[model samples]
Target: MSADRPELDRCSRCGECRAVCPVFRETRRETDVARGRLLRYRLARDAGRFSAADREAFSRCLLCGRCLEACKAQVDVPALMQIAKTDSGFAAGWPSLLTEKTLADDGRLDAAVRRYRSLSRWLGRATPDDSGLRLRFALPYLDAGRLYPKPPARGYLEQHTGRRASGVQKLAFFAGCGAGRLLTGVGEAVDRVLAELNLTAAIPEQACCGLAAWGIGATDAARRTAIAWVRSFAGEEYDAILSPCASCTAHLQTRLPQILAGTEFAADAARLAAKVEDFFAWLSRQDLCFDLAGLKVGAHVPCHARREVRDGAAFVSFLKKSGAELVKIDERLDAQCCGMGGSFGVLHPELSRRIGLPKVAALRAAGAAVLVTNCTGCLWQLRDLAARFDPALPVRHPVELLDR
Candidate 1:
């Protein structure tokens, strides 16, 4: 945690973060903003332990990196928050333990999702479009009104593990939990788009990218998951490692190497990081023509894509190239978080909903025929939001629009 002291000290207390933090805007609580959290961290560092109030303050962040973007001193608030969570021992609790045991293991993760699928069938009511299910009653972590995606009969990895496509470049596909399991159609769209380019990607046997674990301050769990991910791609002859999940790609390209900086696999992680690419950024570089002309497409650039991958330019370029009429929403709402901060929504559902509603309302007002985003988490949140706010408007992955 001392390693992050310098970064935490860099905060100028400028209050510029107040202009961009979605959580702070909603709560207007000083404890929920970057400056207040940093001050608490400093006090806790001097005190040798975090107080109960300090721990609660640290848990309130979205870790969206918007504060970092606004800070002229370029303070790394997200990293500081993670370190604080670890220092406070809150990360070793049940949430992190669950992620470590289930998400880090592909078999257990799959089994857990299958169990949810079974439960959904028995107790959940199907939506009008049959795209997802709604519960008649709320569960422990699930809400009664939330729309959950219909689980595919088989996941993308289960169906395509041994499937191969031939192309000049050796490419590897990492279907993250969302695309691989919950939202299988996004994975299918990725395949269709690749086929249009006459390129085949090797689908690798992989687990979660550990972004969720890292966000929750489960550094050990995140580190173990990352190590397993690096090993999954090691000894493979691939020119690039591609993922449809922007959050996963960003974590792999930027954070994974740092997580394993002093480990034995550091070199391998660095090499893989260099090769990791977001599906949209990679496809944007290709000479493929898409017939999205006249389609009114609303875009939700995930926070990770904008802050970590720095792919906003590529995302905009891709949409413009497709001849899709990009619908313009409110300036305040544009590029704001969709409030699916991985586990943030699960932990703080009401705050997450409040932060997300404005963006959904803006899109609906803009008359967007459909909403498109590349991140699986954003897809789930946006889809649920659209279903509740505007059922006629569909949510889709960018690749799906291109493949069409």
Candidate 2:
């Protein structure tokens, strides 16, 4: 396979990203910046002294696609980093104990979610407003009085599409890993909204989208997972693949197609890629209406979402039409990262918190009681941060705020 070295080398070595990079902002080291890492890898190549630490350093990136957005040349930092991770031993580690076990048995995820919902209900703490995986295990540290609505016994598309489903506008609902586990309510809300548009949605049992795998330098595993996922749903007669998670949508729209290129999965991956659409984008194109007049909300567009579909202004526009008084939190020093850049928080918790502090403060000062966004990682990061600093403000999905 040919490498896109020209594009990778497009980094001008400008430390400008250093000032705005959420990771670099916390680390204050050149090595933490995108260019610095690229340069180090280059030097290691020339001198033949590349060490394991160098490989692991690149693995630590959130793959949030922030550096590319900041780059004038728009270098694909995540792709390049993934390649570097592939060369290292990064792919050798089995995913987390939870990830391994969950991926190994799909039923466990649903079971965990169902149990949590039941426990929350029995505790009289369950409401339709709850977010996250309704897990009783996480309730102690994770559930800070946040009540999530019970999932509509069946997903929206399942009701509209019928069990043995077929429709003119068939959609494969890619309930992202977290969607089924942590944010099932959001997934349910997505189905409800799609049903309102008369679209048939199907949730094919699948593996993780391989994003977390890629972010940690498990490139081969990520590619294999993507290929398997695409192949699993390839021949299905579907018009589009719908995803509520911004990361999942972006991966389906970009990574899967790229990795499956030239393979048997290529055509199907491309076909699925073409049909992939963001939930926010789908809602905007629909005829749904909601009365959000009483709510004041702020939006934090994920970096990848901005890269994939651009600043998410169209989504904000739809929210405004739905009657939300939308306010944007401007970042003078850096674009908002909320610090949950996926596994970055797991790998570098202290650094992630340091970088996310500013964004959290911005939300607190926005004077909006609710902060709405499309990314699950953003919600998780911001919610955890809020719990630490100011837990009164609720972070929600824009679709959740919409009237069905």
Distance from true location, Cα of 327 in model 1, Å: 1.1
Off by over 4 Å in 1: 95-97, 128-131, 310-313
RMSD of 1: 1.9
Candidate 1 local lDDT, 350-390, one digit each (tens):
78888887887887788788888888888888878887788
| Clashes by residue pair, model 2 | 127-149, 128-149, 129-147, 129-148, 129-149, 130-147, 130-148, 130-149, 132-182, 133-182
Clash count per candidate: 0, 10
Task: Tell me the TM-score of model 2.
Answer: 0.81
How far is 14's C-alpha from truth in model 2 (Å)? 3.3
Model 2 weakest 10-residue run by lDDT: 155-164
Whole-model lDDT values for every prediction: 0.80, 0.65
Measured by TM-score, the strongest candidate is 1
Work out the TM-score per prediction. 0.94, 0.81
Q: Alpha carbon lDDT of residue 188, candidate 2? A: 67
